[model samples]
Target: MKTISWGIIGCGDVNEIKSGPAFNKINGSVLSAVMRRDKEKAADYARRHQVPSFYGDAQDLINDPGINAVYVATPPGPHEEYTIASLTAGKPVYVEKPMSLDAESCRRMAAAAAQTGTKLTVAHYRRALPMFRKVKTLLNEIGDVSLVTIRFFQPKASALVANSEENWRVDPAISGGGLFHDMAPHHIDLMLYFFGEPLSIHGHSANQAKMNRADDIVMGQLVFPGEVFCTGAWCFNVPKEFASDECEIIGSLGKIVFPFHGNEVSLHTGGEVAVHRFEHPQHIQQPMIAEVVRYFSGEAAENPCPAEAGIKVLTIIDRFTGK
Candidate 1:
């Protein structure tokens, strides 16, 4: 079997254990290098994660011939640049979503991937989660999916007020927007995965909790290919809100409820409900990152999250942002 080595561009929160360890554990894969702007932090991450090399600059790691792919975990603002650079270098990229702040950058990255003949994948990790896969199966089992609803409610601004300005999420330029852009891609992508493209959409967002640049609360309605209706919202500032990621699919036979009890899904059928859940102990990034290794080795048929899928999500996001 061919071996695939990986270099990670941003060795921050997401790479801790879930993703970093998987490179070494997955079949015929290795996490050979890592990079961060801070030299000491990058070196420390490399040491801790058992990566063979570390660099203070991203380009240095990407240029490594031993590295077959690069994972970009930086914030949304710079996703386009690094991802395009990696693809241009003829290395597959598994970038964290939202792929870019807007649609045009997504197009540019996709075009870069096509031009270079390299695999460009987005880390829409929800697709790799086991429980969500079951939901997809249940949907297929029960035909005539008519309505879908996904709700994601996070904390208010003050509630999550950081002592330092280092928390870039509050800045629209860095995060793309408020919770909608930061968090909605996961939910919205699930909508697209379960159903098809949304025919049309109408969206409204407001900074009810007080923030800069964009809305903390956003709600939108999407009409899917079969006239399937999906209503999704990201409400950040309520008197009380839990970290909720939920979806309800109402079908002719029955309805499936993915009540955000951890990352599991529940089914409601025959006037009674049963739980169908599979918890991924690893962080969402690991399996998808590992799969890229498989794709490169010809052990896998396709990228787990293809560039086109990210483009579709960006297309929807563009409609929401009106650009």
Candidate 2:
């Protein structure tokens, strides 16, 4: 097995804990280098993380002969640019979620991957997580899944938003829209992963708070092929008392309930309810990273989360935001 030397672009807050260190922790993977537009900060990150090298230019990192795979951790705006560049360089890519600023960009990125025959995976890492896999198993207990309700409410400047100018989540030009664009990819992807493709999509977005440039409220509905329907409501400017992150899947026999951001799942069947609790890995992305490494090594037959799947998600977002 060959080591997959990873060069990460946009070593920002997301990498501070959620993913950065996992490269070396996983066998057959190494964090060889990193890149950021700010050369001084790039070197600082390199030194603190003990990375061998750092660069101000993404191309410098991508062209590094030692790097075999690239992790594009930048905002969605540049996802297509870096992904295509890496694939063109004959290197695979593991891009962060919300694949691009919009569905069209996602299509272009997927096209590049197809043209180059290079691997491209999205960081919908939740699909490979144990809790969600258990949720998938528990779904079987729900006789005939019919409806899913998703609710994610937060006050202004929620902890998840990462208070910084680099807060790309709410910047429409960079993240495509507001909190909905930033967070919905995970829920939407998991929905498709669990229930399959939708037959129709409907949604609307509004900026009720007008606190920022992006929309604060978004409501969406999706009807899947199996008569499964999902309705989602996301509000980022809710009251402090009303903050909640929950999703419920209902079926004829029973129902399953869990938080999209939490680690507990509740199964309601028969006359009783059972709760399953899980602890996230120190690096939650490590499991998916491992699978990507195997796929990169040619030991795994397929990438864990392909561009097609991520693009499907982006398409759904387009419909939701009415873009």
Candidate 3:
């Protein structure tokens, strides 16, 4: 694939701006086609985005001779099916985060890619964000790391607490679990990128809110290869005033603090503190999509966020959720 002519499956909200526009914006990349279960919506998306074609069935998009790569932007439930089909059609793939519904599905997707010799990557786009890169730099400046902690507390009124079947994020049948399954992958993937695979992981989760079948709270600890200790707590039933989203990394010399959802990165060392704030791009996933294009075009050596790395994060989530 010298130039990446892309076809996207499940062009929903995520595709509107986060990724869809990026395909055409990147060098040597084109938004050749798109697929959605709703033909009207798929046609509308294609017309609005200036894509050449649209399809009502995934296989039609996958088999499009004009498309050289596929982006599986659907929900977690069908990721493995669409991804494997795309690979079997001899096209590289860029699937959305959480990789698949479970570890076994992730492994199957990975195996399919291996079998077909097609490149596959997950949209753990945070790995390519400026704010996260700043965090990595601050970690390096903080010297030898000693411990790390992640905390996420949300008010009861947050949309994530919705228990309706319409809210697929909390619907286990489609989403695999709750918002934890949807959101935790970003943070966990970053943790894996910063520190290698965990040597040991112990964690637990519960439905403290009774708002949904999925767990609204989760707590876990991970021991990394260099004796680095890490802990994480996520709760969705906190008071509005008590809500928080932060991560702190303590090193032998000092510590760094930042929020996974915020723009600020703070560093404390030598009795001095500094804060750096990074504003996100309008099309947040464009940078990462550019990297993916580069990899597919053979301009880059490796995919930044590969299926193997994503599977590791899912495995960690499995240990916490007992799935």
Candidate 4:
């Protein structure tokens, strides 16, 4: 793992820009290979990305001698399988968010990493992004936090989902739920990062639209250790004009406000308001990928987003969905 040669499994839309190019952009990292069930598509992606090789099977990519680390970018359905295999083969791994199908599967991946003594990191990439990092830093200025509320109302006609011939994001069997399953991980992970683990989680979900296979609305609350509370609502059937995305952190002194997907933060304190704005990176996940490379190359001490943290997120999601 001297130079951190990488192998990627699954070529989803996220890989196209968010992560794939980042491997090559980092100092000690290289995108050595890629894999997809369709060999033609895999080769095409490799060619387009200037990767050295591609494979039709994930196992082949994992076993490739040129690759020292593996990135599992596939849907959650096969995350556990590929992650366990990569670890068993003595390869470090960076698995996508929502870690796996559920908390149990994440635990299995973590157990395999422990038994095999291999490194595994989860792609809660926001944990390393600039805007979100600023949000965490600003939490100190807000004084003792009391309550945080999140509202993400996306119109069904314009849901922000990955493009694909088969829409697995709304397929409960493969994605574990609907658009909420696809997007909630980032916000939920941020809450945990800001406020530690929760003592209890409670919520519910429903397919209010009846036009989709999975739930179109989800609402939940988290009880943080210091009695800090967080409640969120995610709705996909809202009218296009009513669609909104915002998070408000109310505190003893002042409060902070921001959107989960946007790059602006507003702070209110002492009867004054200040705002901060950031430009999105060409590769939004590059910051996290840089850290992951360091971790895999032994320059860093620990996993950036470990499986243990991922399990907590899955737990909250399950509680909210009543799984």
Candidate 5:
């Protein structure tokens, strides 16, 4: 099998732990190069991760003949431009979440991938997590799912002001919206994965915490197929006591509670409750990164998370914002 040379674009916080090291860990993938707008910062990340090369410009990495694939870890704003550039250069791309801030850019990305015939994937890491896999398995363990609720509460973005300008995420012109576009994409995608398309969406958002010019908190109500209702909120103002991201699946026979970053879930059935701990996997990004390498080597089917799924999430976000 051919080893895919991977180049990382945007070496920032998300790259430090979430994905940067996965390129080095995958069997058929090599972390050949990384790029950041700041040469010093990029060099720091490269040295820390032991990557072979570092570039101050994305074009430098994209133009490298040794980089068979590129991973865009930057903010959602520049996803379209960088992804299109990589694909046009005949390189596969694995982009971060919320592929773009709007549906139009998402469509353009999907079209470009199709035009170039370059495989495209997104960093929807939850689909590859063990606990979420357990949740997917137990979807039918109880009975038909009736309601799904996901709650993510954290300290308001106002409190932690780091990286406010390093990335374009907080800027409405670049990021589209605040919490709704920035963080809720994962939860929305998971909802679509568990249930089908939502027929109706009714919700509201507010700049309660004054995190930015956009709404700091968003609450959504989605009516999925088969009457499976989902309600969720992205609040950055919650206290430390309630700081967590968890999803609850309520079925006809039981209820399942999955805590993010935790290995187990609480299941209650027929008035009998039990705790189920998942078998921890190697790492969150390992399988997903490996799968991409395998795909690039012609040893697998199409990438699991495609651009269409991302477009759907963007549409849902638009619905919430009346865009």
Candidate 6:
């Protein structure tokens, strides 16, 4: 309660840098334990990270009395289960994005948190990142924002080539869908943060490349309050040179341009453009984790990304993918 002693479930590649080490780096927080299905890997991670404990079973980590918090770093399929378990065990939970396999699962997790009176936050870390924060400020300066567009085009990464069933990101049963499900939460959550609740959403998806069961392309249009409109397109089968990641927000007087995965922010008005850049931290999730720690420590009332915000995003994806 005074400090966050954390246990991580499914500490894999994402945990290796994006989030795992952040628990230790943040003040009033410590990475007390980690769990992975592979005991050797779990032990190795504990050793390398100097964590005091590690477990091959998730329940053991969840049950650890020393761990006051749990981070669900597993794939979407298991997120709901572990998050429910952690909440039931009377520990606060920080779950990865895309919250769960579907909106229903997200709903169940939210219910569990409510029942247990435990805090639950989603790792929509972009909400706390500097680049996105700058974009938000620019949106305000641009006057009454009326339109927004999100575009992500990338060639198929080698890892998404369906090398094995173990590559769960492309496996619908495990990942909820494909890379869009994996990556779109950041953009979608940012939209929610910046624009408030969506008035309506219309979406379509297709597996253009036939790379996997999940869609390789998705497009959506969302209408928000104040007659604000937004459109987004994500395509994973583009040529290498054609690859791009950008979001443009236009208002009556000017526009703001930035990328969800990049650091540059461009502001345009009066026929002039200004560009600003930011470098991400080595442990990219640290800033957000620090905020979560502060929330858990009772120094802050609001979670940076609460379970409700995460559920809204999954609902949007579910509406698009029809799942």
Give the best candidate by lDDT. 4
Candidate 2, which ten residues in sequence have the lowest lDDT sum?
159-168
**What is the C-alpha local distance difference test score of candidate 4?**
0.92
Reference-based lDDT, residue 48, model 1: 82
Local distance difference test values of all predictions, in order: 0.78, 0.92, 0.89, 0.92, 0.82, 0.90
Q: Write the per-residue lDDT of candidate 2 for residues 223-267, one digit (tens) a residue.
A: 997899999999999888999999999999999999988899999
Model with the higher lDDT, candidate 2 or 4: 4
Q: Candidate 3: where is the Cα deviation over 4 Å?
A: 159-165
Model 1: what TM-score?
Answer: 0.92
Model 1, global lDDT: 0.78
How much is 42 displaced in model 5, in angstroms? 1.6
lDDT of 1 by residue, 1-323 (tens): 38878898888865786577778887788889999888899999988877899999988988998888888988789899999899999988888889988878888999999899988878887777777777888886556889888777766653322233266766789877765776678777878787777789887767775656677877788999887998887777655536566778898878888753365666777777777657675555666666677777778887788877888887787776565
lDDT of 6 by residue, 47-74 (tens): 9999999999999999888999999998
What is the model-wide C-alpha lDDT for candidate 5? 0.82
Say which prediction, candidate 3 or candidate 4, comes out ahead on TM-score: 4
TM-score for all models, in order of appearance: 0.92, 0.98, 0.96, 0.98, 0.92, 0.97
For residues 254-285, could you state the per-residue lDDT of candidate 5 as single tens digits?
Answer: 99998655678888888888888876545467
Candidate 3 matches the true fold with a TM-score of 0.96
In model 3, the Cα lDDT at residue 203 comes to: 93
Pairs clashing within candidate 6: none
Candidate 1 off by > 4 Å:
157-165, 241-244
Residue lDDT tens for model 3, 162-261: 2432578887888888888888898899999888899999999999989988888999899998899999998888898888888999998899999887
